[model samples]
Target: MSLFSGSLQKYGQIDILVSNAAANLSIDPIVSMSEKALDKLWEINVKASIQIVQAAAPFLSDGSSVIFVTSVAAFNPGTGFLNMYAVMKTALLGLTKALAAELAPKTRVNGIAPGFVPTRFSAFLAESAEILAEIESKILLKRLGTTDDMAAAAAFLASDDASYITGETLVIAGGAQSRL
Candidate 1:
């Protein structure tokens, strides 16, 4: 982030902030989780993101878009599986709306809850090549998600295309049902 701070200030007045940094641990139940593990997730996944926003808030221009790369765990709350990681993602929704209200009519801050994309974060879900096929059976698309799929959404949210949208969290979960 220091690299971003020192450098990219010249990029179109930094009208867009793609808060994509995150941390995910393998599936673990909360009962046996250690305080150390919980704190680490909150620090890196939650507070770190908020701090990034705090640092960039001053530089963000009106009409800018800040997209937080959040997770479906926020809504699903199998918060048990990822310990504090899920809790932090859940908190991000409220955070997004709060910041949006505070910075409204100016910067448009939003979030994206991506489903189980084929990334290291999800490596814990499946180890076999056939595992995705097995998991895809539950998702309507019958396929896992991709980073590009998410990039396009973020692009739309950050570009002038979504000028009227704000304080909303877009879900990119391949048709997975969401209660939010």
Candidate 2:
């Protein structure tokens, strides 16, 4: 069975939806990036979230929450290598606001922009001691973020505690110059 059907069968109703799928298919600059890589990035990073929301919209309960796992790169691309990934994440920022407006008064939509975390997805950032140290030095906390840190923010957004919150992307980047 599909995930939607399986979820409905198990839970009866969908209260919280978190669209966290992402991909960085290429590290090449935008000008040099291949069409296939761009397509893959768009498919996994942006379109997948929209598809999930579309499929789950019918089953989402009243006062339900929808959270998107955006990236700090949305606001600050940092370097050329990450430009395309940042562009896709920037699209998600817009998607979050638009979806929040579209689903308001019943379903809330928000997002979290995480900093450099040592996950397998971000292991490249920590591969070299010099690079890791440089990154950590830039953070006000002087440390990389943890999965627990991200989970806490997500849990808060998903819970009733954040009832008044919507259409906002929280930056959990340890004061890493995310915004102006």
Best by lDDT: 2
Lowest lDDT block of 10, candidate 2: 1-10
For model 1, the run of ten residues with the poorest summed lDDT: 3-12
TM-score to native of every candidate shown: 0.88, 0.96
Model 2 CA RMSD to the hidden true structure, in angstroms: 1.4
- The lDDT, on a scale of 0 to 1, for candidate 2 is 0.92
- Which residue pairs show collisions in model 1? none
After superposition, which runs of candidate 1 have C-alpha atoms over 4 Å from their true positions?
Answer: 1-5, 8-12, 129-131
Error of 2 at 171 (Å): 0.3
- Displacement of residue 42 (Cα, Å) in model 2 is 0.3
Top TM-score prediction, candidate number:
2
lDDT of 2 at 92: 94
lDDT of 2 by residue, 61-121 (tens): 9999999999988997746578999999999999999999999989999999998889989
